[model samples]
Target: MRSHEHAAIGALCGALAVTLLARGRSFLEKLALWTYGLLLSVFIDLDHFVIARAKTGSWSYLTRAVRHPVWAFTEQESVFPDVEMKLDRLASHVLIGGGLVLALRPLSRLLAVFSAVVVYAHVLADLLREIEVA
Candidate 1:
């Protein structure tokens, strides 16, 4: 996708986050949710970078750190650490997603009461695939 599209999507995400925070949730809850998203985004980006670098023969800083002798040696034992980590990641995502949805539920209901059509439009737009033309 183009940078502009990414920016627009990011803006929409930020607005949705802000709206949820402002309307039905406490500032701390909003902050925590936002932080969760921030961390999730970082992880997603890290994974993306890793995959991209693997494809193109480049390295991200974090990947490089993992390649360093100390870190690589430390991580060598973990081929697969059971299902606990996977379950934990799944639980965290579900909790964050559900929390955000619940926080916005009141606002969404109120919007529906007022007949607003744009309530979940951002989310729909976000889910739509971006087809980039070469």
Candidate 2:
């Protein structure tokens, strides 16, 4: 899926998160949680750069994407083609989400759960997109 699609999904998840988990939070607090969730959901894909480094021994794709943020994000399929399914590894999404949730747990249960759910939602959506594309 495109980054924008992930973002739209993130936006929806953020709204749902605020509705479901932030009951009793002040408006500003709820807004903060929603924003955090959305940002987390969208940025979790940054792990792909680490994965690329491990597999390809360089950050060519990451740097290219960074250099052309708008085109890289909007034209992701063209910018980051996976003709051979080279980007199919699962560790990036799963491990990063797990690690983040573990790290955030001590700070606040709400933050931990919210991060886990948002990451899970992002991964699930990506997996579903993979399935559809395959």
| Highest-TM-score candidate | 2
User: lDDT (CA) for every model shown?
Assistant: 0.41, 0.80
lDDT of 1 by residue, 14-113 (tens): 4466565446777885555444443433332223334435445666444655667475335532422221233333334345445655676677644222
How does residue 89 of candidate 2 score in lDDT?
A: 41
lDDT, candidate 2, 1-134, per-residue tens: 66778788988998897899889999999999999988888887777677667767878888888898888777866754642333454557788889998999999999899888898889889888878977
Clashing pairs in 2: none
Off by over 4 Å in 2: 82-89
Clashes of each: 0, 0
Clashes of 2: 0
TM-scores for all candidates: the values are: 0.32, 0.89
The positional error of residue 132 in candidate 1, measured at the CA in angstroms, is 4.0
